[model samples]
Target chain A: MSEAGEFDFIAQHLAPLSQGYEGAFGLTDDAAILADVPGLVITTDTMIQGVHFRKLEPWDLVARKALRVNLSDLAAMGADPHAVLLSITWPQAVRPAQMQRFVDGLKTDLEAFGIPLIGGDTTRGGELLVVTVTALGQCEHPLLRSGGEAGQDLYVSGTIGDAVLGLEVDTLAGLTGVHKAIVEDRHLLPTPRLKLGRELCGLASAALDVSDGLVADAGHLARASGVKAGIELDSIPLSSAAETWVRIQRDPIATLVKLITSGDDYELLFSAGPEKREEILAAAKRAGTHIARIGSLIEGKGVEVRTTSGELVRIDQAGFTHF
Target chain B: MSEAGEFDFIAQHLAPLSQGYEGAFGLTDDAAILADVPGLVITTDTMIQGVHFRKLEPWDLVARKALRVNLSDLAAMGADPHAVLLSITWPQAVRPAQMQRFVDGLKTDLEAFGIPLIGGDTTRGGELLVVTVTALGQCEHPLLRSGGEAGQDLYVSGTIGDAVLGLEVDTLAGLTGVHKAIVEDRHLLPTPRLKLGRELCGLASAALDVSDGLVADAGHLARASGVKAGIELDSIPLSSAAETWVRIQRDPIATLVKLITSGDDYELLFSAGPEKREEILAAAKRAGTHIARIGSLIEGKGVEVRTTSGELVRIDQAGFTHF
Candidate 1:
């Protein structure tokens, strides 16, 4: 079977990326199927030209980012992604060769993540390109934000402030070239903590991916669990570049606060009981990722930042959102 | 769990449409879980403003059409749709109330189809409103276009040409108001012949929805099946309004050809053995829809149309695509 008109180009380009998944049906059928029954986790994310990315960004990277964000959501739910359904609203201005580059990039990551493209739609419309990816996964112990209670230790996988800090090129202008590239790379290609999320399945009490700022997502976790998350400002994890950028700031604590509030961090923010600390560290080690206990969930509401000595750090809060 | 920022509006408005699906989890979790996957069939479609619809189209209808198109794909595969994951990139120009109407429209169909909203993502960007829907379904035996054999009888469920004809207001200007309204309604809201598709699961040798016009889609089915489809021009079913319009046309056959060449008919076109004719009619009766034996597959290639007397009718075949 072959894809019909308007959609033929997609199947011609992407059928190879289906990776022989029996359900993909060579992208010939209008729909794909998953034959077996298991716990299914589904998440979707959309990236549009000019909004989620600059027009000059490499098509491959844009495709990868579009995919990883959804995979990150699956990871946050402690699910291992198996397949994806993509919907691309292509603009007339985008050359077919550019779309081929986009598909090439998608193919690269689809193979890397071992998640095949099972189904999708390709259409011509809009002046701005829009890509929407829905990731499908299966997990035995799915994580949730409402699973935590008071007295749970809040933890984050990998470095927190880097991705957000990576966006502040002006603040990092004085830094070394290598340091600048490190932070910028973090912003461009975020490695989803899939293995770590799977490891935390039965361990973490609550979990979610921090696409919104750490503080904001922490507030979400707290609100969902009906508790307050108290984070020690000094304890937030940072990459070496972030550390260097913060050291030059007149008020280092204020800079750190700003880092935590400016989102685009695809890291996982989660909570677990104190009893699971050793196991979590072990899980992180096995996953080859770092985990830090940045804060603790307490009886209250919303998120609060405090110094190591318990001195409260009141954030300006204004312009904290991306809008 | 509760939804976080950037997606709060989607959850708050459409969460009610989740319809108590366990996987929806109140649209709170980062991803939704479908605990039991019974042969999961998935399909996705996207509609962008100024492309799929005009700026004046009602948001509610736009939302329904978006969902229905994906559902129609599932129907083409002889699957029972169970859930959908929506990704809407809301434009800044679209007011909150307008978005509310979109959700309301989505809610109406979600309930009508009994397909719950399991998961989705909402972000603001672009000057065009983009709505992408990924539908999930279950089917024990999915019908496929490759299933047809040379001798199979080609059948189509329900009328075909009304949708395309509905797009031409100037062509129908001389028609009565009631006749004009009928075709226009068919254009605005297409009924995905889901029940008919489900019934065709075992009976159909090949199947697909007619979104690409009857003749074009027949070409697709024939090419996929490695055979030829010979359609009887007079056998193509039509609504009363279409019949009346064709009667007044200076060239009725030419008008018919034009109608079949233009797309957007969400009807099921399939192939089955003559042995299943009685059974298929019974099935269509049970589905409460009309069925017509329009064509037959032969040991050849591509599609051909003929009159009742077997006279060849050549279609211009240009501008047949919506693009």
Candidate 2:
């Protein structure tokens, strides 16, 4: 823990994050007040040391990952970032410099995302560092997972499986050069796709960010919308690094299945009518984000994945289970 | 941890809390949307095991305390409770039944306050449980700590230092009967004073909940408002139980000073014009809460506690430090 008390800590270190935000009162008030807050979207995420990231990982990167995860949730709901509240549980043993680095990263992202830090509490407790971020967003009509129709086309933004690989980069033998950095960056920091989500607000029927593996998240959309999502295995987009990693494996199809089943992919997945494909393409172009037509939703109950040669892929599990 | 995963846990256990709140999407959506969110007040608090509570503390009371602390913050801002988001980090060793009790307590308070659970996240990891709650409130004009004037009369609601005594009740010999329970309950489950806060809306110039001890919190108000706060030691109100405990101490004045400097008193302290004394009494009466005239704000800086005969009292330390 730092030498400063909670009040001193806020005034000296965290108060700057609230600068330019009138409602934040430079975080001097007991609670922040937003004069106008219509159509607000709220999402929260918690990241812990040793659980979400390695103990030796840099604090700034950890802070970025924590903030981006919450932002990603806002994007999934088709909301633009508005403001944020952060609750940081500092382990007593960590250096104050590490925490300063984390705060610096928060400053960078708040500026980049154009969101202000409103109100939060800092406490010294527990053995592991924990950060819980609550991001409040604005949206006219949030695109929910339950809005999908059977005839709509399934589309996914950016490449998948890279973040999961990023977590295991050090363990994966012979994975070096740009491939290592590419995958590692995905784990350390993620793009929230707020602009892409904004573009899809009216164009797409259903949307969500894929964090708990593509297949498990598809199941979530399916269950919510009372439809089946069928993905063509060959059409699933992969980063060049993942492609290189996959080719060296003995069974490529099995390796691909493993990639899809692994979690931590922060990419937007949505469904739209076939007639709006061109419009979605234009939308993706405007957002400057890569998107691919992966599959389609059908009038059924769950999720299914099959190869071009008509082989069904069996997935034992699709994501992390807390228990 | 339970056999149920995150999705199943939400569906089976937590979805009921979100039933009437449409924005919560029955706790199924990635994020919740509040259609109208003007004049919003946002506050967050994080509580950790072994730090905030004992390892064997009952989960339901723990949950109640967590919820009330956030509510207390809202009350301090003179905002009505609107909604809540809870992020729980579960330990792997805890039984599911304990978590259920916590949920039950949350349900009780949510119904009692007419505040719905709008959104939250649940994750499992680490050796200790952590609960973080973000409360959203509404108010036209939030009562900030900086709104006080030098001539305003200072008042405190309920009694001071009961909670701190409650924490040390076991250690203080011969302290028994109703006094022990009163102090323990004050420590375990504090009243948020929402009604009193609402009553003080336009009446009080500055208001804040006393969480970080009376003297320290008064110092905060003084520093924020650029004024001075002086409290008479003889005029400070205390519960009958505390009066009895004080008489047994070696120096009652020293005990009172100790009480004022110790934290965890969740009482509302505010400043108002002396002309509004009668009106403030009526407001407190209607809210069914006790109020005491303690002192007044003066033109200057910092806080002072004086004996009725006009002698300055010295304080070594006013509150806890994170380090």
Instruction: Tell me the whole-model lDDT of each prediction, alpha carbons only.
Output: 0.85, 0.86
TM-score of 2: 0.97
- Clash list (residue pairs), candidate 1: none
Model 2 residue B116 lDDT score: 84
lDDT of 2 by residue, A99-204 (tens): 8899888888888888889888887866788899999898988989999989889999999889888888987676667998999898789899999999899889
Residue lDDT tens for model 2, B1-323: 43236677778777887757879999888899874856889999888888887787788988989999999999999899998999998886768798889988888888889888888888777788789999989888788898888888999999998988988878878677788999989999999999999888998999999887899888888888889999988778899888888989999888999889887788899999989999999999999999999999999988899998999998777654444
Candidate 2 DockQ vs. native? 0.68
Compute the lDDT of residue B122 as modeled in candidate 1. 73
Off by over 4 Å in 1: A1-8, A168-172, A316-323, B1-11, B316-319
| lDDT of each residue in B245-290, candidate 1, tens digit only | 8888899999889878778899999999989999999999989989
Chain B TM per candidate, please? Answer: 0.95, 0.96
Model 1: share of real contacts kept: 0.77
Clashes of 1: 0
The candidate maximizing TM-score is: 2
In model 1, state the lDDT of residue B43: 89
* Each prediction's fraction of true contacts recovered: 0.77, 0.80
